[model samples]
Target: MTVSRRAGLLSAFLLPSVLTATTATGAALAQEGKPREVVSTISSGYFDDYLMLAVDGKAKTLSGYYNDGKCRFIFRDALSPTELYQRSELGEAYVVDSWDPDHPDRHFTTTLYSKTPNGYRNQLTLEPGSRDENRPKACRNRISLDRSSWVSESFYDVAVVRKRGARVFTIARAGEKPTPAPRKDRLPPPGTGVWIDRTYSAAFSPKGFVRLNWYDPPGTPHGGYVRQEDLYPSQPLPQRDGGDEAVQ
Candidate 1:
């Protein structure tokens, strides 16, 4: 899709009213200090991602199931009622990315899910995460299902470098000049791949720039800003053998 078109769609999706309603609901639930359950389903063509969140206000815990068509992953985390409300207001929380070292293909760092007026929406993270040896062996399990009945477009947030000689800015302002990022930080040439957090993109869209992270050749993570015009949405590219290679 064209950048303009995508921007328009994103603007509508991130309307202030939608975010406010979600925050208000979460706040009310926390105030009640009672147990509650929230179920969210995202249909994407033949695959559907399902999540069921059960919050125990008194116990200060949150547990849920995250089904990604291929596997049913169990998620359990300790979070106070106040923290739960705060996380909901922020529109994201930490979830197990990967538990098995044998399956590198399934690795991911962050998981984004939020309640919206229509339903809950999730953005699949393409960036891989380190294997967690502490996680239980049962954290991931295969599932079989007929997915033909599901039908909806899936959107993954990936950013492709669209301009050459693009420099990373430690800080970016709409009208002000941008300050160059530290010399240690760098971005691959145009056509290389990167990704951004949807929440950050939406929050900074009005300013015409978004902050993102990229790894140096040695795999060190660095954060900086780039002009929104320098990027276009695209699917993640395949990683080369050996450790994670920045999409080239």
Candidate 2:
């Protein structure tokens, strides 16, 4: 999409109704209060925003979601109503509910916890068949026959695996971006975008995973929505002063 066209789309998305949550009451309601484990009900709000992963050698994918609010969660092979939740401070965060928004039959459970100066721990117990060694993986293609559509354009990187005979074809993004045309283009070539390293494994199966993550910025591209400066004058996207890669 052209720069001007991309801007218009973003502007429409950033409409007042689509604004991010910030109310103290609502946030606190969604906050992790102590630790609890039991059959629970979740809101579609949890899995709303996410990152995608594809396993080139397998028949699954790893899907992740984050709350613009203290939590980010990822789910492997949508196995059951049981889900796993992870939390981090200082960035967009929120809890992820496992129930499907469109289909009420599917669900998952997760234990909530807090990591302070003391140590890391889980506050809840396993639900029925939940595995002891908690990790990440994509769901069986059963739930989302169209995993491609379930994810956003920026999340195309999640589909690393293609069915040997059951091919899950994706709308390969636009061709290689020779360059960031005019800074207002609507999309990035499938290969270009913010990338992170991750290993996704399927549930109840032998542990199998590979590291590499790919992602693109949301919306058409950088141009009609005004700069982040104009919208949130109170806070700005952080500027990293310095950083270094650590040995794994």
Candidate 3:
């Protein structure tokens, strides 16, 4: 479905990437005992903009796209630790909190590791909400991997639209458009209750414009199984958590 270019629907809804909480010190590594609240607020550069891909409500996720070596991530539209239990579209929650307050609050985390020559090679893990009892059983036995690729594009501005009903939106930039490649033999399993392996590529133009490209094999009922993911690029990691600045 084509989206409206109206600033309200497109720009307002483009969930801006920003810092969640705040870190005690701007200059320090995230260690135990004194973990800082990972804030992901927008900056002056591309890290300031963020985009959202809505799929039948419940803000799936949010984040900042890669622009320079200083890759920053933003996580907005947080679902209270309990909201995960009451869902509508994105199937059942696979990652849930262990209920232990001391832990990482059982939310989504954006981890960036050493990128290899082939695909993304970082270990990013997110635990479902504590009340998410409907998580897939396999989630207990093994970890569910929903991997996506990153490009030097500008997918930072996420446009939000408050529709009266649920709508499925495939969030992708102009270049990194969305594609269909799900199903029995497809790369990412596009189905509910199953771990869908997504392949997200990116692109950019000489004008310094960047966007995201996603592959959701199971699209909507009009075409595929429908509904999935809320994008988040401004997720916190070892870098770009607090407002720490480093010389490039």
* Best model per TM-score: 1
Superposed by TM-score, candidate 3 places the C-alpha of residue 190 at a distance from the truth, in angstroms, of 5.8
**TM-score per candidate, in order?**
0.27, 0.20, 0.22
Compared with the true structure, model 2 gives a TM-score of 0.20
lDDT of 1 by residue, 1-248 (tens): 99999999999988987889999999998889864443334333221324333344443433333444443333333432111334455233333333222233444432334344433233322112325444334434222223232221211223456687676765445455444333444567754444343333443443666666544442455556677787643223333355322221
Model 2 / residue 248 / CA error / Å: 37
Q: In order, what lDDT does every prediction score?
A: 0.42, 0.26, 0.26
Q: What is the C-alpha RMSD of each candidate to the true structure, in Å?
A: 24.2, 26.2, 24.4
| Model 3 alpha-carbon drift over 4 Å, by segment | 1-76, 79-121, 129-131, 141-148, 156-212, 215-248
Shift of residue 177 alpha carbon in model 1, Å: 12
Clashes of each: 0, 29, 46
